[model samples]
Target: MNATPTEMMTIAAARLLTNQDVCFVGIGAPSAACNLARLTHAPKITLIYESGTLSTRPSVLPLSIGDGELCDTALTTVAVPEMFRYWLQGGRITIGFLGGAQIDRFANLNTTVVGPYDAPKVRLPGGGGAPEIASNCGEIFITMAMGTRAFVDRLPFITSFGHGKGKGDRAALGLKTKGPTKVMTDLCVLEPDPQTAELTVVSLHPGVTREQVQAACGWPLRFAADVAETPPATEQELAVLRDLHARTRQAHGVAA
Candidate 1:
């Protein structure tokens, strides 16, 4: 099957996770990305779920952290406290993959509310363990589709701190994670500027224009001095991704 832009984004995101990475995987796109990595180049990558499943190698993508597939395939399961204390906060995990309702230039995420916290226009699923994941992991990789609504100028509420205000804010707050290091979107790949720690476009997907990306973002987006075009997903990657999703649908009884 040919890859869609979203699939391309997932493949690109998966490629970033190396065999050496111990990734703290989220449920949605993050789960798919990590699983793809495990199926492909990053076969040795350790996957730790929020529900305490460690080194999980599920046959299909899990619906949530509590899904039986995760625990069934995991090397071992620990209590939530031990998962957080000994694995996450203990500085064992290398990458934290996240998604957000709204993201700012500094990559601070808001999964709590859409509008004012007091009287929100939309109340979103509150961050579950994301704050800890953001703070404790060695680095964070955010995957989201780019849109003006999602790429907001000011987040109404910050559910997980990224670079915060940029610069040394994370360090000032005593956060051990390096904060958001990369953002993979349907249109492009963004990374923080080395000097300012502000999110900047580092690569664009095939056929995506700079103007399109700029228009999607709420704030004025920045571009690296030498932006590169993201390579399209190879046939092998597309096959793996398709198979993964197919099995996920089959396992859940979703129509193909």
Candidate 2:
């Protein structure tokens, strides 16, 4: 059988991160992608966590930023405040790995509330350190499963942050960081427009169609006029990615 969508997403994210200068990673998809990069390429990258761990080398994806495994494998865990202030806020982190409860075309994220701010739909896990990471990290790499529910036209609340307000806002704000550098989804890879930072599908998987991608997104999605086909995962890439997931599931006690 071919790789699953989740596996494809991880591989796309991993390839993008393989050459990042530095990464401020969150848990889950980002963790898997970051570790994949470490195991393959970009060994010199400095991986920092919001929990104050730096240069961690975990054999599996972390359950959360504060998981003890992070501390154990870290080069050295430092004071939390110092981590945010001295490193993150100081703009030392070159890339940030982000996931979201909801996202928009601009790659803005919301993890605070699902429906009305006052009351309504589900209330997701509060943005623990996401707000800080979203704004502080030099650049961001968003990883999320593609579905109408998750990639909304607009988020109910602004939980974290966006690339300024819209288009040229990030540049106008004099932000040196690249904002969101890339977005990896199950069916395609998206990139922000050079001028507007609006997300456009740059590449699509072999069997995925533009109509299907748009159908799956919550909002009216945009596609590049000339989108390219994504390169299929090489045997080596697939093997490494599969091995990583197997190891992660085993560690987390996922039922065999």
- Model 1: lDDT equals 0.92
Model 1 clashing residue pairs (backbone): none
lDDT of 2 at 77: 97
lDDT of all the models against the reference?
0.92, 0.83
Per-candidate TM-scores read 0.98, 0.93
lDDT by residue for model 2 over 1-256, one digit each (tens)? 4767887888788888655567898888888888888877767667888889988888777777877888998999999999989999998888889988788888889888988978958978888888878778877899999998889887888877777457777667666567787889989999987777788999997688999899889877778889998888777778877788888788889964
Candidate 2: regions farther than 4 A off? 171-174
Clashes of each: 0, 0
Weakest 10 consecutive residues of candidate 2 by summed lDDT: 162-171
Model 2: lDDT to the true structure: 0.83
